[model samples]
Target: MTDPLLTETREDEKTAAWWRQAAVYQIYPRSFADANGDGLGDIPGIVSRVDYLAQLGIDAVWLSPFYPSALADGGYDVADYRDVDPRLGTLEDFDAMVAALHERGIRVVVDIVPNHTSDLHEWFQEALAAGRGSDARERYIFRDGEGPDGAEPPTDWGAAFGGPAWERVEDGQWYLHSFATEQPDLNWDHPEVRADFLKTLRFWSDRGVDGFRIDVAHMLTKDLTEPLPSRAELELLDRSSGRHPLADRDEVHEIYAEWRKVFNEYDPPRTAVAEAWVETPERRAKYASAEGLGQAFNFDLLVADFDADQFLRIIADNLEQARATGSSTTWVLSNHDVTRHATRYGLAPLAGRPVKQGVEWVAAGGPEDELDRARGARRANAATLLLLGLPGSTYLYQGEELGLHEVAAISAEQRQDPSFFRGASFDGLGRDGCRVPLPWTASGSSFGFGADGAHLPQPAWFAEHAVDVEAADPSSTLSLYRDALRLRHLLQAEEALVWTDTGRADVLRFARPNGWEIVTNFGEEPFDLAADAANVVLSSLALDGQLLPGEATAWIAPA
Candidate 1:
């Protein structure tokens, strides 16, 4: 019904489109793959896994930061945004990796940490050495007068990792660092600072990158005049690095809008995924509007306690809040920065009891025990499916499809995270458990990541539940993930996902235009099919209608 030229244009648009109904896989590169025997993940290593990711049916792969760095903050505190970190690979290697992934129709989006830079970063060093009242000093937030006099910091805020937020730079001056001392905050108000950031963004965009995931986006601006944290906490925090205020000033949006303008200049258009963990709906909407960021990571699901009512409310609330902001929302389960959801939700261990399945799976001795394990797996599976079928975008962490759980035993010596180093105990050694290397093969020393064991060890469980082992077994969680992902993409709905008024908070029901009703039971008991329901389309459980542990089901027209 259309001319060939017009059809070709639409095809081209589809290929370049960055923000559509899609699923994204986040790869913490250092922990994703290691090609050479150097014990570190590299560009070639990531290239080798493109096919594996492609099979997962994701439209794009969002790689964590890979720029040149001092390995501080795991590459977030970049030294050179234009060059590749030697530990990862050369710039040429990165170009080749990009080419390889694009050849298979998968877009690439990398993280950009503009809020701060490594104190060792040339720019930061220049600013610091330039001393007070120098132009270079304006690039950072350096204060004058008698600094933190062994008392309280300049603000009553705790560092995200732990302790106080401000650190003394010299005898009479201090600098603001919300994270660590080695990482110094950039002054967003500085013209040169903004110019350098734009240059870095454009450099990557010009290289055919699909988009960027802005790191700690809300922390770009701070109130230097705020009061400091408790004296005791300040002393402890300073032992690591002084802290700074959190998410200060809405003026950050104005700065982001300017960057958005540059991003829009791309012929195919580009996206800026903001990392703002907005606590309120009104505040969240501002980052995803037409004049703001293209999309923002919605941590609403992350903070949920994994109850049926809470899950439903979070989804419904986000949908309402993001509707006016161009209806582009991102749903994420696990990331390099958070504990895996399955472990967090207690699905792996219910009521202080461990339910064993997958990798370390134990076949129950009795049918009753088997049913209980199946039921648990069904609930976990249902929640994941529910997320994929939701409106807007879905983000799947590297190992989530394998239903990976938290490592029960990680010694203090193995803990290398900035958070752990800063005395942050409960907030999880700063995502190190989830950031462990992916396990692709069960037999190999590196679990199929590389010839040698990766620099950071994969959890010990990988020996039991690697992808290669699961791929050979038809009943593995890896297989279920592939099935779910394929089904999600095969869905031929023109309209986006829409929720149904199922009334029961424990039961999440939604309908696609293709006559499919996806229902998930998050409760501890069975949910009978509603009178109007026809038949089961997809079940995360066994064929006996007994919802297995961590399983889910989708229903449609009866035969």
Candidate 2:
């Protein structure tokens, strides 16, 4: 029987040693740390805290966009590929950070926004100046048609941010921007464009960065004929233009294959983890084939509502796909771009289960307060173990280990992302709630996040969630995260096989081949096992059979 994942597998399998056993920690740099006492985070800040990250038991760190840009799209819009943003720091600061991180055996992966460039980027500006009459016009797709009443978009495609996908250029011609108008999609079909991108890749690789996490990897190539539509989405195609937009483009794979070659040329093993959001498993696999990407994010698991069937299907599908093509799949639940998993599952401090054994904060009183905090820590601990138990690459967003929930109050004025301005509707407004600055103190309201007169306002009650307080308390969420990550490393050292057994869907279970069986009751109610008196290695619950609420997980070994 033919495997479903293989678009085409070659004899040579590209290997990146750092990735296999890696526990990649994704840092949205803007919120990670601010060096220079500036409210905004910079490379110097990251450098200052290199040891903090190294201690997290992570093999690598994927830093989101530090490139020079207008910040229209929160640094996704690239103004310069070779230069570090002045606001971020000088290029030397980056080199220093990389060297410091290397000393601690932590590989650094930077974000590469290849699909599009900021309107302020030299290339985009040049393309605009060249206009409809020049060849540069081919750099981006241009169409001529009267929109609604000669003013609305010609198609019904909406922007991922929340507005029309097409923007009328100064020249009076409509240009396609699946995201913000400031972020014009690049034409990968152009030979010059491809050459420029390769050069950019080379530039970064020469700078000694370990690898790149290609942003919106699937959106690089688009269907020029039928632009994306703008309206309420009924089908997947309705949401995205009927055109493939980016994935499975022959040209795209070809370009990616060349990028693979570039990475191979580096001295040490380097990688390129593609952020491809293709819905179909087949399409996702094609991007991860030996000739295409090193690994692609399996986002199907991220959006999957908590359920046994969905969780099992996700693992099985990805495992089948990756193994077929001899490629790796990236498993993750939350990122800076979406609602945090804890928040998504409605794990808010609401009135439901017993308050004492719940994740709610109450006035410091009897053992009930201690029990509440303990339960919250356990919920976070089990969830982390569950995600880490899955096979293939896993991405842990910053502060996720702290079990951070989505902050509720982010007024329109506080919103800084450009995606929000583009989309008229706030459905899936680029995850600002989860991307807010990290909490690091328990003394003041700002959580020691900023000095007085900072650019970004600190959220109210920030101090309550600071790392200092959590670090001091052994049972705090911070300690739980550190312990869980350390546990994953230990499991790997024991030669555990993180493989998938497609026997049950509703019951999310995995084993080490060695007696360890990790299982989760993704659904409500207790699940009895075939084995009698299983050795419960770890559980989200107490000895008493109280089913820990949503996403409750446990680890066991057959007696």
Candidate 3:
């Protein structure tokens, strides 16, 4: 019996690096499978699931931050960079998990939060204990208040989460924090700060970790001498022509360049990917240049509307930038930070804003304007097919294979995201909707995420999309992913994508070198396939005869 989902192209023996064509899975450790009866997922829980990941056909797993912290920002606030939080596991547990992943041919990439550290970090604690002018205070961005008697904040910069960026201590000195007040920004200008991160990087690299995913990579260097920009100015700054005073500074590249030397010291040469939120493709390219971090996430595709023209423009622009920098383009649909693509696709498109910026706006839409779940699922499946066919490494957030949508109804009291607590100025509802634990079993406490209740409440609907239920149904989204991934090697050919003219403005048709054609319909109506495209290998939705439905994508091979 031939599998309908499998492609005919044979796996190639190309000598390209693993990351260039790899399908990396992103795991938010706290929301993945939990092994112990504890409500939260742990390192051991991840180890127990290595077989599951291996079966899914992913080449690598990028674990979100698990370092010891107060969980002020979903573990992004790190108190200790060298060890796992006791709540998560010990250092020994981490090593064992890494060993388990490596044994299964899956590489490990851990998150490194270099821009800031938790207020409880020993360095920050010591800085507070020491006087304002002490060497201990130099590690972080702490300064005397600007006004008389040192009362006013040093700058007017606002926190990324919300409120003022500066927080005053008992001593009347103000400290800078781009995120939550509990997560203070580190002073990269200090030599000790650079040395400390180098040591931290080596600690993980020596433990055989494959790579690092840098958090807030562009905001590392800030010009303390300059006054902070106004909120309006800051919002405009991301798109403005000038360099930002607090982000994407020219000096930030120097830090990565130095780190590149550390990365090269390893045998296969460890790599780093930056999470830069710069405006233009040219600015993004600089972060992924030879002298800087090897790769930076290109999120234009993630935020673009579900239109053929928008998709083509973003794809072309990213490819062009990647080519100029000699960096592999990275494509991702969803992650822990934003609303899941499934839910995002369900909402009506916002006129003037990109999808990423319209989450709060979507949330504001009343229950009368509820999500079109069926449409969202179909579009998500098509999007994944489109993403996998693109010519670069791809990232899949956990549970996306299960077709999970954002649990938007999570109560405010149950929400854990720091941003939610910060108020409407920060666009409040928070990212908790997308970080709910994966539903493993159709019937179990917390759907088999653990014996105990999940850290974040899982909506009752999760039972229908549980792994066990999906695994039993061949037509489920999970099955589609498994089959698509098993045959993804067909997309590994190092050739440029050739656009095919479908004679319709609303349909996007492109072909790879292997005679594999991908057609996606963005119009409001079904599209009739050409005679040669009748041999369909995969379709996001069941076809209506030879017609491809709107918001659907299909992979077809030559007859």
Query: Relative to the true structure, how large is the alpha-carbon lDDT of every model?
Result: 0.69, 0.67, 0.82
- Determine which window of 10 residues in candidate 2 has minimal summed lDDT: 357-366
* C-alpha root-mean-square deviation, candidate 1: 7.2
Instruction: Compare the candidates by lDDT and give the number of the best one.
Output: 3
Output candidate 3 Cα RMSD: 4.5
Q: Candidate 1 residues 1-559, lDDT tens each?
A: 1111000112354544446567888988888888887877778889888888878778888999888877767878788878898888898888888888888878889998888888878877787677778898788887653444644445555666676656776545667777876778889889998998889888888887888898988778755553444546544532111132346257788888898899889877777788886556667677777687767889877756556777767776666665666546788877877767766654433234343322222211111223333344445566787777666678888887777765534556765678767766434345566777878887778888888777665666676668888777766777777877777765534324466655556766766555566677676555666443446655666444434222355544323
Q: What is the C-alpha RMSD of each candidate to the true structure, in Å?
A: 7.2, 6.6, 4.5
Error of 1 at 418 (Å): 1.5
Over 4 Å off, model 1: 1-18, 145-157, 170-172, 225-248, 347-378, 425-428, 492-498, 501-505, 530-537, 545-551, 555-559
Candidate achieving the largest TM-score? 3
Q: What is candidate 3's local distance difference test score?
A: 0.82
Candidate 3 lDDT trough over 10 residues, lowest sum? 1-10
Better of 1 and 3 by TM-score: 3
